[model samples]
Target: MRKRVLDVAEESFQARGYHASSLGDLMMAAGITGGALHHHFPTKKALAMAVIEERVAAAVEQTWIAPLLAAASAREGVRSVFEAVAAELERQGFVRGCPLNNLAHELALADPDFRIALSGIFSTWRQALADKIASDQQAGVEQGTDPQRFAALAVAAYSGAMSMAKTAQDASILRDCLAALKPV
Candidate 1:
C-alpha cells in the first residue's frame, strides 16, 4: 500500500509540480481515502520527499550510476551513459525532462526541505561521476582532467541539454548534446 501510494505520488509529482499537486489529487489518482494517504504519508511534503529519495534517486542510479560502474573506462562510461539517455529520450519523444531537474526547478527556491533533498541527489550523482573520473585518472586514462570540475561540467551540460530538449519538444537537442560530448 505504501509503495502503491508512492508510485502514484511520484508520477503525479513529476507530471505536475509539487505545489500544484495536492493530497486530494493524489488520493483520487491513487484511489485511496484521505485516511489511507495520511497513514502512508503524514503530509504532502513527506510524500514528495519520499518520491525524491526513492523514485528519483533510483532512476538516477539505474540510468547513470550502474552503467558508469560497469564501464571499463571513464570515457566509455560517460559516453555510454549519455548515449543511452539520448536514445531513451529519442524513443520517448523527449516529452518530459529529467525528474530530478524538474523537481529542482519547481521546488528548489520555494522550499528548503525539497532543495536539500534534491541537492543531496545531485551531490551523490556528481560524486559518483567524479569517483569514476578519479579512478580513470589513477589508471592514466585522464591525465590532465580535473575529476571534480569535469564531473560538474558534465552534469551541467546534461541538465542544460535536458532543459532545452523539453522546451523545444525535440529529442534532437539531446542527440546533439551527446555528439558534442564525444572526444575530438
Candidate 2:
C-alpha cells in the first residue's frame, strides 16, 4: 500500500505539479482511503517528500547515474543517454520533460525541503558524471576539460534542452542541443 501510494504520487506529481495534485485526487488515484493514506504518510508534504527522496532519486540513479558509470567514457555515456532519451520521447510522442527538472522548477522555490532534496539529486548526478569524466581523462579517453565544470554544464544543458523540448513539444530539440554542446 505504501509503495502503491508513492508510485501513484510520483506519477501524479510528474504529470501535474505538486501544488495542483490535491490530496483527494491523489487518494482517488491511489484508490486509498484517508486512513490508509495517513497511516503511511501523515501529511501531503510527507508523501511528496517520500516521492522526492525515494521515487525521484531512484529514477535519476537508474536513468543517468548507473548508465553513465557503466559506460566506457563520460562523453559516450552522455551522448548515449541523450540519444536514448530523444528516441524514447519520439516513440512516446509526448514530451513531459525530465522528471527531476519538472519538480525542481515547480517546488524548488516553494519549500526549503524540496530545494534541498532536489539539489541533492542534481549534486549526485553531477558528481557521478564528474567522476566518470575524471576516470576517462586519466585513461586518455578525454582531454582539455575540467570534469566538475563539464558535469555542471552537461546537467544545465540537458535541463535547458529538456525544458525547451517540453515547451516546443519536439524531441529533436534535444538532439540539436546535444549537437550544440559537443559534450566532452
What lDDT does each candidate get?
0.85, 0.90
Residue-level lDDT tens digits of model 2 in 74-144: 88888878988999999999998898999999999999999999999999999999999889989987788
**What digit string (tens of lDDT, one per residue) describes model 1 on residues 1-184?**
8988998888887777788888898898888999999997998888988999999999999988889889987667777877888788778764588899999999899889999999999999899989998998788788888889988988888788888888888767667777777763
TM-score of 1: 0.95
Name the runs in model 1 displaced over 4 angstroms.
none
TM-score of each: 0.95, 0.96
Candidate 1: lDDT over CA atoms? 0.85
